[model samples]
Target: MAHEVPGTELNINTTSNDQSAEVGNAGGVASAGTVQAPVGTASVSRKRQGSPLEAENPWVIDIIREATSKQIHEELKASFLRGEPDMSAATVFFAEVNQKIQKANDEHGAERDRGTIPGDAYEKLYADFKTALEKAKLERNEEAALYVVQETHSKFAKFNQEHHLPEEWNINPDAFKHDSMPEVAPKPEPQDNDSLFSGSLPDYTGSETDIPDNVSTLEELEREARYNQSLSAGEVLYWWKRGVGTQTFVQYGQGSSKTYRIRAGSYEVYDPESVPRILSSGALSGDPSSVSCQGKQKLQYRNEKGRIEEAWAYTRDQVRGIVGVGWKVDDDDEEGIEPLDLLVPEPYATYPHTRILVLWVDGAVTLEDRAFIRRITKGSYLNVARIIYHKALRQEIRYRKAERLPYEHLLDRMPTRAKEKQDIELGDEEYEQDGEELNSVEEVQPEYRGSVQASTIRSASTRPPSNHGRSRTSEVRFVEPALEPRRPTSERGTARPSPNRVPHKSVDIEDPRDAKIRWLEEQLEMSLNRNHQSSYDSSSRWRRYNRYDGRQSEVSEYTPEPRRRRRAVHRERVWDNWTGSWVTARRVY
Candidate 1:
């Protein structure tokens, strides 16, 4: 048992009578009859080094106990070999062993009672260990702890190896095992941001977030730098400079209908474990037409079988960098990934998660674009309008306290109370069936209602006689009135052409000879009438008629006789035949 010094609770366990004798000589303990030592005076006042008092420091006892046990284990073996007579050694060994066993018991007891190690006791143990190592003049406490740590590690390793573990353990399994493991391919690593902003680009790794560092195309870099000045945090913008555009990611599916806030850093993309950084400055307008990177030019190293292995540590930006000179003028054109386009950057070599925020200004601030702007900015219409004004008008937009702008006022701006329309959610099955019913009702409304109205009107106009006693004939006569006949041309007093009368000779003359003879007689009569008319003078009522005779006229047969007599009677006179007058003619006799 450890001897308690006067006015002290120090447990100094000594083996054999010699050690106890030495301790008693150095510091005497008060006997039962002796004047009781002052309880807290000397012991508390005493300057203790190496081991402090029990209450002030219980750890001393604990360390002593453990050291005692180790000593005992060693002594037991030594004593067995020596075969006794060395009482001092035996006593010292047992004393140390007993102290260590008590300490172990105390520890187990504490755990049983409290369900965990006491905070104070742990502090004591750690302190004692620290003191022991210091006293021993060890180079480092870690060197001592390594023994326990290595033993524990070996035990676990042996167990795992015996049980046939799949592979070696690692804090970063992918970083170590990716290249060697043929079964699982490594995902493309994110490139350094520095490389992407620059114009030197490498291959793309099929990830939108794999934009490079400073290496961007001259055009892309310039465009992005300009756009960068105009963005807000969490505002999703297409970073086309690095070939990471809104259209590039759109193929996966319909993106957030509202603009989703962009997470900062390339690692955040497709890496859920990556802690995304939010852009505090809210860079709004840094959209580039295309991208480039330095991931292609950078190199890195890894530890192999006691040697460093040289390999590429690509960043998201570098992995996406491709060999292209110009921007993709067409927004919809998305190129496929190629091997020659792979890039690796330096900074991404060791950092865990490095991501960049991409804010997309899809269209100029329009009403439709405002919806997405609202989601991304987490702002209201008025707020977005203010942003637009700052961007477009280059001046701060202000509003009256009680008034609103046209666009702002027209938004879904009704008061909460006014917007209390009932909205009940229905299952898909119910919704589809209800929609069908509604469509059917709409389809039948016009056709059936018009037909029904027409039928009702007809029934009202031609109602079946209420009094069935009415005669059917009277009903029919009243319903059907008499009609008037239409007048013919003769009855209307209009003149009609008279029928031609045919002579007996000309009538029904089908033969050509008969028709000709009848036609000549008619012409002869017409000519005779015309000659008689021409001979009459307007002053006289009498007209000279041509007297028809059976014989031919002599004057007609000898026409030369009349001509000779006429020439003798009026040799110098010329007849005006056209006007039927006489006139003198130039004599050419």
Candidate 2:
């Protein structure tokens, strides 16, 4: 027969009948003894035999105790291969042990309630379990060390993931191996001076020979500077003197047109040479009258004592008057044309006859013919008057104002207005005013040299008092111009006022000091309203205490509410897994 123990699963067997009878008696005695045993004593004996925690789940403690480095490595490898990120054998082993410890405590509490265990039983068991773990750690065994290393690496990998650190920052076990060491390059030898600076030095001995002579160089530089200054000032006289001149003669039967050409930067002819060529080519033979000289003749002569002289002769006064009409020379032509004689007298005097004639027609010759012509004969330069014309068109005259001699105006004792008509007939447009329409110069005002004060006083006395100070002496108050005020056409409320209407007050007319004061007052009011609104809003957002009922209310003002007691907040530095740094965690009750 086999009989089981009271609180345990162990069974005892009897071998013979006598032994069975003795066992039965002993069982009865044991049963009676167990019932009479003290609760603390029974609990102590049960603990001595085996802990209830181990009895319930023995594998948890057995795995922790019997773990090896090889087993841990295999488990870690398997876990990695299985792609289990957060789970590991070491973490599981500790978790199960902790659960077993919690269960032991719960059982100890139940035993204490049934009067089987003492009140301090759970505490004593916890202390014993902690001692065992400490003993296992202090043993310096391979499995424990490997578990620590693996746990550290696992925590580091988790920290890397949580903190978003680079993967290279994580510990790699393979990197620690001997085969993973990197090779270092050998140190270079110190270089000699010759080897360091390998290139040859430049030869600077012959540099002085490249310099030029100072006097000629300075003259050339001055010439260049003068040329550049002339260019910058746009002095056409300089270019005109430097220009080359030529002549083209086209004869059609007894009539011919002599055109002049001048080349400064470009070629400019007095008349188109192609017109004569085209007409002489028989293209216009159908109209023979178009080729008539029209009382104009081109006379060319050369005397034995004088140079070649050319002139355009007009047989009729009407023909001469028709040429170069309504044209005038610029006021600065004296400076532009006279400077060439002083600068280059030889060239100015001995230049080609054709060039001189072209210059005269172009209104560029401010001097007399004697300055440009070497010798003059009656027939050599006959019928050549001081007539100026456009450089590009022979018929368009360029008039110039006659030079006034000193005291020349004293000879004319007539009134200035009397001569204005004569000046207008002479084509003096400069004297014409812009806005005034001069229908006839004969319409002149009567000369009144009387005192202006007398006339002003008489005019002021006849006008009304309202117009006395407002009317200007220059303006006639008898007649007012007929101009109607414009009215706004739009009927909208936002229509702008008529531009002619004078506003009572304008922003442009407002005094800056008064405007600043008004602006400051408005800003002050706005700030006050803003502060009041903010206070009201903040008070509404939070709970407002009522003095009478000690409850929340809509009103912001309260009569001396009690101050809330401040609790001491416990602050501790805890490791933040996500941030991978220590942060202050606060606890308040």
Find the candidate with the highest TM-score and give its number.
1
lDDT of all the models against the reference? 0.30, 0.32
TM-score of every model?
0.16, 0.14
Query: What digit string (tens of lDDT, one per residue) describes model 1 on residues 1-589?
Result: 3332333333332332123111122333334222222233333223233332233333333334324433443444454334222335534543543454354335434322221122232233334433543443344334454343344335434532332211121012222122212232356999866764575755667678666674567878665754653332122223322334221111110111111222223412222223221122322233232222212223556565667565533332222111011111122222432111111112222111112112212311111132333333434554433333222111001111112222222111111222221110111242223221111111111222223443223233233222223222211213433222233346656343335632222123378888899899999988754433233323322224545432233333222211222343335776898989888776643
Per lDDT, the best of the predicted structures is 2
225: Cα error in model 2, Å? 34
